[model samples]
Target: MGRRRSAVLTVLIALVAIYSLVPLAWLVVNATKTQEGLLSSFGLWFDDGRFALFDNVRQTLTYDDGVFVRWLGNTLLYVVAGAGGATLLATLGGYGLAKFDFPGKRAVFAVVIGAVAVPGTALAVPTFLMFSRMGLTNTPWSVIIPSLVSPFGLYLMWTFSQQAVPDEMLEAARIDGAGEFHTFFRVSAPLLGPGIVTVLLFTVVATWNNYFLPLIMLKDPQWYPLTIGLNSWNDQAQTVGGQAVFNLVITGSLLTILPLLAAFLLLQRYWQSGLAAGSVKE
Candidate 1:
């Protein structure tokens, strides 16, 4: 019976994997075709004598006076600032809520958890109006400031720190003449490594893929991130006086995903180690 169940689960997982990989496989093959070839050929594979991967990549980077590179830079800036800020704030706030006691603490937790239930899309219009009134709608702060708040991240850290960080360790630090700030920075912070990295990865992916906030916040193409920039290329393909850059869009999308894929692959070991270490304490 167990063997039969295992076989069924394996089949289900394989089907799920194929379902996810099909679109990615389509993207890769289509990226190698010309705009003309894309419209003409089978989508899953390259047609005979139609491999144009190099040309597509060259045009993707060089199109519109190297605008793609500028957009890449803009995306990097936003991801670093927004994700880094979000992780730091979540870490500090979560740690504080976990380790420290204050008046109305339960109420604070309740409010934060309630905020998590609120969909981000629902707040977009009101947030836009608020930023508009403050003359910040089109500025970088408009995206960065909002990105810094992560209710889910706070909840994750608050829960993790309770288990990972012990009261006795904090008391020992206090006995060693460490200030509250110093103890948190020096002692509790290191122990929360797994939770911090977990929060960082979540924020990084969230910030990197963020589209709606930046779309509404930015007006200038010069400030557009990869998401909007690639979409603009797609829109241009259907517009008058614009070159058909569908192939370039495909290649550019492939390029956009590379950084994120690399981030996950490189940090994967840290994630495993952090989780393992968190489970074992001195």
Candidate 2:
């Protein structure tokens, strides 16, 4: 009976694996083929003739007046500025709320929770109007400012702070003559490493994938990120008949995913450690 059940589970897992990998397999196979080969030959297999993969990359970079590179740069800037700033703000605000007792504290926490429940898309129009009033639209700030205010990130930090940080440690630091800010920096922040990393990872992915906000805010193509750039390529593909942009689009998609993969792999240790830390402590 045990062997029979194991065999059945193995088959089920195999089917699930194939379902997940089939699309990725198709993408890799299609990306290697030329435009002619893509349309002419079986898509899942390689063709007799080969076009240089380097050439495709070159064309993708140089096409549309080399705007793709600009988009890549813009994406990096947004992730670093928006995500980095949001993570910092969330950490500070969360730590304060968790440790300090002051007037309107409950009100502040309630407001932050309410903000987290609100969809970012619902606020986009209002944000645009406010930015427009300040004459900040069509600029990097329009995107960066919105990305910096992440209520979910704040909530994550608050939860982490409440559980991960100990009151005894804070009291010890206070008795040692460390001021509140100094104690937080020296004592609390070091222990909150996992939470900080968690917030950073979440912020990075959110800023990287953001589209509608940038679309409504940015009119200039030069400021476009990879999401918008690839979309434009897809839109123009129909008009440019016989063009190899389909392959370029696939290649661009692969390139866009590479950085995200690298980031997650590099930060996986911290993420695991954070989860373990939280569970073991509380």
| TM-score for all models, in order of appearance | 0.95, 0.89
In candidate 1, how many Å is residue 22 off?
Answer: 1.1
Instruction: Please give the distance, in angstroms, between residue 64's alpha carbon in candidate 1 and its true position after superposition.
Output: 0.6
Residue lDDT tens for model 2, 1-282: 999999999999999999988877777777777888878878677767895466667877887788888999999999999999999999999988888899998899899999999999999999999999999999999999999998998999998899778999999989999999999889888789988988899999999999999989988988988998898888877674836588788777777877887899988888787677767664
How many clashes (backbone atoms < 3 Å, residues ≥3 apart in a chain or on different chains) does model 1 have?
A: 0
Task: Tell me how candidate 2 scores on lDDT.
Answer: 0.87
| Residue 175 accuracy (lDDT) in model 1 | 95
How many clashing residue pairs appear in each of the predictions shown? 0, 0
Please identify model 2 stretches exceeding 4 Å from their true place.
1-20, 240-242, 274-282
lDDT of 1 by residue, 18-114 (tens): 9999999999888888877887888997866667999888998999999999999988888888889989989999999999999999999999999
Best by lDDT: 1
For residue 275, model 2's alpha carbon misses the true position, in angstroms, by: 4.9
Worst 10 residues of 2 by lDDT: 235-244
What C-alpha lDDT do the candidate models reach, one value each?
0.89, 0.87
